[model samples]
Each structure stands twice: as structure tokens, then as C-alpha cells.
Target: MRPETEADLADMIASASGPICVRGGGTRGVHLDGAVLETGGLSGITLYEPGSLTLVARAGTPLAEIEAALDAEGQRLAFEPMDHRGLLGTSGAPTIGGVVSANVSGPRRVSVGACRDFMLGVRYVDGTGTLVKNGGRVMKNVTGYDLVKLMSGSWGTLGVLTEVSLKVLPKPETAAGVLIDGLSDVDAVQAMAKALGSPFEVSGAAHIPRGLNGQPVTMLRIEGFAGSVAYRADQIASLFGGMSVRVERDPETVAKGWAWVRDVDTFQGTEGDVWRVSCTPSDAAGLGAKMKLAALLYDWGGGLIWARVPEGTDLRTRLGAFDGHATLVRGAGQAKFQPEPAPVAALSRGLRARFDPKGILNTGLMG
Candidate 1:
């Protein structure tokens, strides 16, 4: 648990051996074992360029704390990664930098894009112990290579982020959700796709398995002013037709409900192995058809599916067969967050050459 000040970071980068997991309270400790870089020492907001709709903060700032500040100004870091401290059945603080580095996206990703979209700039200690920066506080800069987006999802293999600047948006004044209860996996995917194709401007849509479904819900959430959300939700309901619907006007209920779509908070106690697979929405059902798993949960409409497998069930070849990637999201790891190293994974090995040439930052993570 070595916490480094800015100067200390400069010194360590020059001499450190072994991969350093830049940890923020170990929110993701289960994912890997490497030398830890205790990023909390670097925590603090450096700048809030509200005029440009951007804010810069140290890497280890608590995401909850950042959101509270953003809320006060009616602004938010829009990608909205799921708070896994509670949902993953774990306990600890998660950092916003960690979220972006992980490239996590929640329900709003359907509308706003992932954390990669909002990230604008970064300062980090790279493999060579040199301080490197890319992008700027504003969105339009292209002074050099677009390293900001590259760093966003690099999983700290390239560098240990010291600071990050990102775009922010005004929080919507009101939001409403409508549930279309009792739809099968294929049907639920259809409804979500249909809703997005329409002009109702729906912000969130998801379907949970009926067995896993607490309330048998197929939910659609719309955000804006009271009048706008109310109007859009009504039109969406009309578009979907009467399927035993119930309106959720309660804001707190709406927030809590959408969270399930983010990270399967409701399915926490289910033990075994959980995985997050990225594929086309249509491939979601194929995942069920393919993998023999303990349980499965779908999020991101269907683009992201979470499956709980009996311990030691290999999802690699099965998931890779569907032409997508499966990451070990939780539970014990053969090697956490990593699937059994793929044959063509030398591509990742090659990437390490250009970024962390010395493999001094986070070696095995993306290697």
C-alpha cells in the first residue's frame, strides 16, 4: 500500500518493477494482483472549467464525492458507471478515473456513450517515468495524437493517471420511467430496439430475466423537464402498446431501478462466477443458447450480458464462438477480468510495446 505524492510518482516510475495496480480503495482488487499504486494520495479536483463544461480531478477521487459536487452545480459526468461497491457484493470506494479506465458504461450509454466519450484530458506517469499529457480541458483540441481516448480504456497498462479532465453536462430536471412487464429475452430486445428507433427520445431501456426479475419489468426511462419527460414517456407507452404497464414517477425509485440495469445489483448474492460479454443485441440470446451457466442477466439493452457460471466453467471458447469477448467481471479468477489468454491476444502484447515499452505500469493487465 504505497501512496505516492506527485514527486514521489515521478521517482517511482523511474525505478519500479512489477505491474502496479493503481488502486482507489481496492474497489476492484479482486480483479488482479499486482504491485498497488494507492492513488488516493493524488485525489482532489484540480479544475472545474464549467464555462467549457469540463472538470479536472485527480485519479483517486471518490466517484460518489465527485457526483455530489457535480449535483450541486446541476452537472454530471454523464457516462455514469455503475457503482459496484454495493452491486458487485463488495465494499469500498470506486474512483471516477478507475471507471473510465475500465471503460464502463451504464444504461445512459444507450444515449450518451461510454466514459470514453466524456474524457477530455489526462496527466499520467507513463512507463518511462516521464509525465505525459494529452487532450485539453475543452473538447475540440487535437494538438497531438488523441491519447485521451486511448488512455480512457487502457486499464492502466500504459500509465498511472495523476489527473483527468472530462466533459460534463447539465443534469436533467426531471425523469420518468415506464415498465412493460413480462417480455421474453428476444421480445425484450425487440422492444428496446423498437423504442430507440422511434423519435420518443427515450433515455434508458432494459429487460431482466423473469426468473431474475424482481417485478417482471421491461422498463423505459426518459429524462428532461417534467413536461418533456412526461410527454416522451407517454408517447413511448403509446408506441409500445398496452402490455400491463405501470408508470414510475418517483425519482428515487427511478434511480434505484435503473441501477439494476447498470450492474445487476439485484443479483448480488448469487455466488459462482459472473461475466460481462459484449456482442450485438441479437447475439444475447445466442449467449444463453451457447453457455452452460448458473444464471444470466442482461444489461445495456442486450449489448452487455452478465452470466453467473458454476465455478470453473470455461466461457472462453463458448463466448468467443459468438464472435465477441467475455471478461471475468467478478468472482474467483483463473486470472481476474481476463479470459484464458486468446490465441490472437498477441495483438494486446504488441500494443504494450508502443505504450508501456518497459511494461513498468500495469504489465499483465492488458498484456
Candidate 2:
């Protein structure tokens, strides 16, 4: 029950006999079932070279503070991690280290990649009580291995990340989203694919399938300068012809529109079972084709699907058709987890074991 300072982590690891969870702000507290290693006290920015476009901060620093400082200089962490303020019923002050530990990348992930991409270096206390450092403040060649990337989405399973260094990108001059309405799941996927492949860079494309009575999916987002976005919107519109595409402009409007895509305010399925299914866009349409009663929808250009089903149905059988896997997001009583970790996941686990031999961080979250 102690807050880990830079020096204290080693001692903390030495004392713990079993697995340790790298707790951060306790934002996702309920999701874990282990000894908590709270990270909020490990706060403050260590180094920020604005000219270098790289910054280093303690793992426990609040993400909002990081964003505000970067925003002041017209720069930002490109992956755009979403704040689970509303969803988890906790303060939106997610720690920067927590973001890295969980790899909380948002819609911008479609373009800039995830939190792992910006990771330049890390300082962590591994299991068996070892404090190690890797990479550098600036990007360059590595001699052999890279644990920074390994810990990006490890969900604190490997080691307790104490400090993080990342390269940031300037915020776009202008950003906007073109909401192409009425297109069913099939048409939306085709449209998103087309926009993403075009000359103009469409940063994000999501096909939010109609849910419940009349909720329409918030379609594609195209960023960059206003003129370029408008031009791209027109070119893509030609493909749709008569279909009504609602184009939204300005940062405020764009921010409001992306709320759903960001999973900001819509975590209401807490009352029932919610499943987050990740699959290729091609298979999404057919995977849940037989579910006559489940309330389901799609997002992230149809690659991420959200479904809330009646309590008793077996999720493994229901979502087996889709080539991808589903992780339970809400509601009661079941181990609907993907016990068989994907090949990539096993490789990730190996990397974790390499960094954390004692299995003293986020033990069962990975299992």
C-alpha cells in the first residue's frame, strides 16, 4: 500500500513474493484482480525539449496535464488516448504511464499508430527487483532488443513502468469529419476503404451500425487543413452519388462528433454484458449475422464491434464465426475471455517474461 517513487520500486519488487499489478490512478481498478501497485504518486515531467519534439515524464503524471502542455505549443501525442472518465465513473485524470501500460490509443490510431509508436524510451522496475532503462530521448538505432515496444500494450504484465519518453507531433492545422449517413454496414465499409485509400489522407473512418431503434452510425473522419479535407470529401462524395453525406467542420464539431468513436460517453451497457470484438472489416458483416436479438454495432472503420447480448447466451459460440476475438467489456457472470492468446500475444508474453522473469506485474490480467 505504498506509492512507488523512482527509488522505491526496486524495494517494492523485492518485498512482493507473488505477481504485482502496476496500478495507475486506479482508473480501471475493477478490471484487475491482484495486489495493487498504485502509480499516481510517481508524478511530474522529467524532461521536455520542445525544440526536440520529445518529452519525458514520470509514469504517474496525469495525461490531461501532458496534453495541455503540448497543446500550448501546438503539439500533441498523435495516438490520442481516450479518457475513460465517464465509462469507469472515475476522474478523467488518467496517468501518462497508465496510458502506456494499457496502450490506450484512440481513433487517431488509424493513422498515427498506437501509443507504442511514439515510445522512445522507458525506465521500469522489473520483477525480481531490477530497475532497467532502455532506448533514448530521441529515436535511433538499437544494439539488440527493444523493451519499450514490448511494454506498450503489455497492460503492466511485464514490469512496472516508472517513466516514459515519447516523441510528439504538432496538432493538425484543421480537422473535420464527414458523416456519410444511411449507408448500411456493407456500404459504410466500402466507403471507408475507398476514402482511406485515396490521395487525401483521411485520418479516421468508422461505420457505427444502427443500434436500438434509430441510432445512426457516425461515419468517416478526414483531418488536416480545412481546404484539403473539403476537397477530399467532395471527391469521395462523387462515389456515393445520391446518398446523403453529412459533412461536419471545425474542431468543436469534430470533437463532439468523435466522442462516440472515442468511446467517451457511451458506456451505458454496464448494466448488461458488453463485448468488444476486434476483427477484419471483411468478416464483420457476416460474423454476427445470425444474432437475431443481440444489440450490436460497429466502429473503427468496422474493425471494432460492440455487442450487448442477453445474459445466458454463450459468447464463444455466438462470436466464433468472425476470424478475430472478443473481450468482455461489461456485465456479470462469465469468463468470456480469449484464453487462447493470439500468436502475437504469445510473442508479447515471451517479451514480458524476458523483462519480468518473476511474473511480479499485472499477473493474471495477461493470463
Candidate 3:
């Protein structure tokens, strides 16, 4: 089922019985047993103000469309949302609604913030087919309950988003990468931490256990005016003077390198279950060491670890208790999301009850 208008969407949900599978672009590899409700029919940008760095678009507006519009204005989505197509092996164009629902974020999240931080407002339909609007087009317009943040990262469990207003940032004038070779996972995490701590404003930090040339590489990214980027890259390189360091100044090369890191390209087309582990930067190495991984990629200055293990591996049980959570991104027979603590689980149940009394939206997807 697809509805082109907001009213039509609300009516469709209002009249629905049994479960409904909410979808946008169908890129996230979420499958549930229910009638499918695709939001693609509700597409297009509603508003864009380059000077104000704000954009409003329907839920199903293609992310490429929004990126193109922002690029024309020398701006971009600061969160640097990842393109999950390659990683998930899905072909549909990613949509703004899916980005928000999943709270998709990339390497730059270490410097800026997650997709939820840039959200200025949101319009969604509750489970009862009621339209709910929260916040507004401007930051100051957000007051009272901040449903905008709650809706993000909800994975469509709470409601079906119809429209979104976002705050964007100006594109950097130039960017550079400082590559340090031959660092072990622990050492790489330490090096990345030092680079991120320095005043050079590292925007992206990642470590590939096995890089393209079959060697471990740690990357630190800096972006700004050309001169600033160059100077900062040199300073970062100097921080690891004893190690083999090379500064990549070519704009295309830097962009491509970061994109590869952001999208977890290393694990693409590989056979294994993928797990995204979120922990403190200091704990990342320890967790990775405990895992029996086939491949690993570290991003967000080692705060996020992507582990590829043999199919049907129960990573959570193997790792035991930890400071953060592990999410199954692919190859799932076990649970996809981490089980919440009893208190948190109760709170989540309460929220779902309030938002979706009928429990018809994306039933059992989160479980």
C-alpha cells in the first residue's frame, strides 16, 4: 500500500487491521510479516533555504535529491549519512525518512553529531492514524516535548514519518587525510584518540585491520579552508612522527577514502554476519579482541566497531557484558537489537503503548 498524500496515508493506517510493515525505499533490509506500506509515493522537497541552511522534504524524497540540492548551495548533511545499499545489498534509493528512522550517521559524527541532532522538526502519523507534528523549521521553534529526537532512531516502531525538516552545514573548502600505517588495532585506537584530542579538529577517524594493500591503516581526516586543512594534516602526521605517515591532499582521493570508511565497504559482498558494536573508544579495542571476527572496521575514533563474523554467530553472548550495545546489521536469525534492561524495556513498552495502541506498525521488526 502506498499513499500519495498525508490525509490518504492517515486514512490508510486508520482503516488498517492486523500488522503493517512500514517502509521507505526498502534499503534497510527490514522484513516483517504484514501488509507493506511504502512511503515512496509521498515524495519531493517541500522547502529549502540555502542562506539559513535548512531543508524540508517529504518522507519519501530521495536522499540523492536532497544531497544534490544542498550541494548546489555549497552545503551538506553534516551527519554524513552512510549509503547502506552496498553494505545491505539493497538497491532502492535511500530516502530521507529512512535516514531519520534509522538515525544513519557516518564518520563525521565524531566531530559534528548524529542525524537526530540536525533534525529541526518532523511530521508523522501515529498508530491510530492521527497526524502528529513536533518542532518546526527553525531551531528556536523547538520547544516543549522534543518528539523530533524521539522519532529519530525509532526505526519506524513509534510512528511513520511523513515529513522532516533538517539543519545542514556548509561544505568544507578542502579536506586532507593523514594515513598512518602498521598500527595494530589497540595502537590504532590510541593513535586515533590522540589525533581526535588534538586541536586540529579531526572530522573522521577510522582504522582498517586489513586495508586495500593488505596492510593495517589508521586514517585521520581534517577539513576546512585549503591552508588550514593542509596545516592540520601535517600536525596530525607529526603526532605520529615515528610511524609511517602520508598526507593525502587530493580532494577526490580524500573524499573517496572517507566514503569507503563511512560505508564499511570492506565487508561489502563478503560472506558473514555483520555486527555494529558501540562502546567507549577506550573499550573498543578490548571488545574487538574478544570477538572472533573475520574482518573489522573502526570508525568514530574507535567508538564504533564493525565486525564481520561467521554466519549465525551470537556475538553478544561471546563478548559477554560490555559498556555499550551490539546490533546485528545483517545475517540475522538471532535478535537484531540488543535487549534493553528491564527498566528501559518497561519505558520502551510504555512509549510504544502511548504511540501505537494497536501495535500494528512494523510489528516485531525491532525484536
The TM-score of candidate 3 is: 0.99
Q: What are the lDDT scores of the predictions, listed in order?
A: 0.76, 0.74, 0.93
TM-score of each: 0.92, 0.90, 0.99
Candidate 2 regions exceeding 4 Å error are: 31-34, 211-215, 288-292, 341-353
* Predicted model with the maximum lDDT: 3
State each model's C-alpha RMSD to the native.
2.3, 2.5, 0.8
- lDDT (Cα, tens digit) per residue for candidate 1, span 192-274: 88887788777887776653435456778888898888888888888767577778888778888887667677657766777
Which runs of model 3 end up more than 4 angstroms from their true locations? none
Please list all clashing residue pairs in model 3, or write none if there are none.
Answer: none
| Candidate 1 ranges beyond 4 A from true positions | 1-4, 31-34, 211-215, 292-294, 333-347
Best by TM-score: 3
Model 2 scores what on Cα lDDT? 0.74
lDDT of 2 by residue, 198-228 (tens): 7767778776556333655546677777688
**Residue 264 C-alpha lDDT in model 1:** 77
